[model samples]
Target: MNNTKDFAKSSWIALVLIVLLNSCGSAVKSTPPPLRSQAEVVSVGQDKVEDSVEKKLENVKIGDAQAYYYYQLAVLSLASGNIEEAVDSFYNAIKLDDKSPFLHTELGKALARKGDLSKAKEACEKALGLDPSYLPARTLLAAVYSGLNEKEEAIKEYEKIIELNPREVQPYILLASLYKERKEYDKALGVLNRWIGRHQNSEVGFYHMGQIYLEMKDYEQAARSFEKAIEENGDFIQGYSALGALYENQKQYQKAAETYERALKVLGDDPRVLDRLLRIYTQLKDYNKALAYAEKLKDMSPEDEEIDVDIGVIYYESKQYGEAEKLFRGYLDEHPENIEVRAYLAATLEENQKYDEALKEWEKVLEQDPKSFDTRIRIGMLLSEQGKHDQAIKMFEKTLELFPDRIRSYILLGASYNQAKRYEEGLQVLQKGLAVNEKDPALLATLNFHIGVSLERLGRFEEALTTFKKVVELDDKHSNAHNYIGYMLAEKGIRLDEALVEIQKALELEPDNGAYIDSLGWVYYQKGMIDEAIRELERAVSLIDDDPVIHEHLGDAYTKKGLFQKAVSAYEKSMKLKPENEEQVQKKLEEARVKLKSQITTHTTGR
Candidate 1:
């Protein structure tokens, strides 16, 4: 229902009345003997007193000028928003003129403002009792009912108000809101539509309708409504923002970008608009644009850790790893507790080959939050890559403690155990994983492959061959399985022809994979095709220069071909690459040297 301007004005008066009443309770026992004038009762404005007496009260008969002054003062005070003073002046005015129900309604609103709901209700009822058609009293009654949360009664009062003044807009708005609060969405829309038909030019009406559409997930209608609102009022900031959000939700990134740009024009220096643009640009893969908007947002809120993180991500995604690292460090300095930043920084460092540094960062994250199973797994994987197999196993085991179902951790930990030559532990771990998740293709394949690796390392070639066959049968497309089993078979001298087929299939799947290429080369070497083996091994070494195992394979191929000096050189290079194999390489080197010296001595003696 419509709250008249006077009702709002009267509420302020009610606050003053409460303050004055509380202040006076200990000071004055009764209403002070009637003031000589309303001006004497309170600080009345000069123009107001003069205007009230000269204009509104001149037609009414009062017992004395003080009565006239108080009567006019009450109406003047109510009009002026001095509601408490209005109530007091109204009481005095009634003392002079008691027949006016309109004045009682004013008094009721003041009472309502003071939270005297009971008295306010009585006063409003009395005003209606005195004048059955008193619209102001009825409207005040609705407000009182609303304050008491008597929603049905409030609605009834508002309906009465609408009936009395069919052309008014406020009662329609309130009724619509009431229906919306009750989740009667269709009814709410109906009310709003009817209201919009009458108030078509109201941007507020359009905005409200747009919000309703948004709630219903009617993006098209919502966008249309928001656009209409914007067109009606070009400076409408919320309309533009709402429209932009609608487009974003629809994945119409370009439209969303344009809408946000318009919103930025209307709301200069708004952080929210900048953030929306940043997100949109990221989705569009327009990293440069995303960074620009991110910088703008940072300029406004320099300490916003989320925006800084976004800027870092843009850099990282665009392959500007160095810039990304700097920003990530800057963000970490400010928001050291942010796990996401720590994780991203770790990932970025890992991508840049700073594996040890990344491991340390992930460790810190785990230290802060031991429940971070994902980070623990990443650290374990990094450690394994760096050949810290035992440490990597520990990290993976800790991760398994937190998340027993993460089968990837089992695979990684098992692989690390094999790398450390703890074949028994590796088999047990893969077996445990397989027992739990039999249908998991990746896990099953990995289990079979690792079992084969461990059995072969233990010199159980027959058992290893059986396990490798199981791995290929379970997943023919498992390229590594093909490579390893084929390489193992060729090495064991039991099925050289069959091994060639498996390794060739593996090479077909991943031709450029250096390890797979090396496997093919080693299989050829086992088959005694010295020239072909050398060609394949040389290609593998060229593809991956850092792998000591590949260099060792090259040395073995050369030795098999009777190239003593070349074999020694290849063995020394392998040892230099990985001193962890120094003892084996030195023995091989000494044997090659002795063989070369004996051949030289025999040639000299024969000459």
Candidate 2:
């Protein structure tokens, strides 16, 4: 409903009546108010709000012309969002008509909006004084008391409101909300129970009750209440929303997805529910369902251009970066002001290996939102990926300068320094990060692990081992630290037995980790168990066929077993996989070939 126009038109009757009564000139013709104005085309706009103001407007009657005119202006100003002017008009209307409770209540509302809680309280009190049973005044007074942190007063007002009119559902809901806030769970439930008994199809009470149970950690009761909420009112989207959120919080993703789909069965693919479903599916990595929902949402809400961004994100997550990039670019062409979609485009470009294009987009994003922490991190990481270690280090330093409290920035800057082989700087940076989040074990483990890496690269073996041990102590489940400790022990080859135990423990932590498996194979090889080493290394190779280190380990095992032909094949495969020590691999390949030829000659001669 056009509330401003309707209220303004409603006052026309009083205006004409006053003008005709006190006219100083010839009489003017007056038309009667119609039962249905032209604006009553259909049901009012319930697409957003639940109720229409038409019902409330029926009681609005003004006898004074000047007061009525000021009242009309105030309502019009309120709708136009001119709060100051509306407040002034409301004040003028109240002065001209002090007995009208509606005027006082409206003034109180306007004052509350202006953050003048004291005066608002006074106005609401004045309205209640004029009419003891004025429910609007009581409601406004309750809200004002709540705003002033006078909870007991607010509770009294809501209770009196319910006592005055028990059939009114709003007072019950508001009163229950007050009880819920005070953690009076039983009282809140009792109020809601009364509310449910009094009002038909009032799912809101049950939904609020579900929230209360959820907050109290009563999962069983919460689920039942949510179910009852949805069952009570088929159109209550909040009920389904609460159910979906509850299931997700419990990690019952399948049930959450089912609840989201059930909303469609009742609401027929409401855009709000579909949007939630699209996000939930995306989070679950169910790309097929996510894409399908995105398409349906697009078709349903063609005017919601932001749906294009959602579709692009789905394509991006599914690793169809080409499609994502195309879609994002198309959207940006029409709406270049969309910085968020441009960020998606940058990510897609990075995935597609269009580094230069990605860099440009990141630069544009940084220009638009200079304080975006993640964008700064991404730009630095991209620079590091391109081997521009100095530039990456500088970018990360700037990020640290801007956001000193962000622990991740310190980690990133440290990583860049470590990549540049500046071990001291990397160590110092990690230590700085450790100073703050000293109590967060996960963060400590991360910083200590990176520090350990820097120490290992600096040839500080014993210190690095000690740091890794510290990391394990901080977080025993940290598989990376376990693998590092095991790999380092195996490489030293002094404590072969201890190395074997460590590597086995690492494999126990992450059974499918190819690097840990390779460490195990290396431990076996150092112990002269060539056959065992070969088996483990071959398994590691199968697990991570692209790893050069695993292939090289298999080659070494084959050489130890004197299977020169197989050894030659393994070394050639290692070389093909691009081992870092290419020259060493080439020398090993030559030696393996010579050994194979010698073996072949000896076998033939012996035959």
lDDT of 1 by residue, 134-245 (tens): 7778767776766566768877887787677655555565666666656777877787677667654566667777878878788888888899889878877768877887
Per-candidate TM-score against the hidden true structure: 0.57, 0.75
lDDT of 1 at 295: 92
Candidates' lDDT values, in order? Answer: 0.75, 0.80
Error of 2 at 571 (Å): 3.2
RMSD of each: 12.5, 9.5
| Tens-digit per-residue lDDT, 348-433, candidate 2 | 99999999899999999999999999999899999999999999999999999998887887889998999998999999998899
User: What does the lDDT come to for candidate 1?
Assistant: 0.75
- Compute the lDDT of residue 399 as modeled in candidate 2: 97
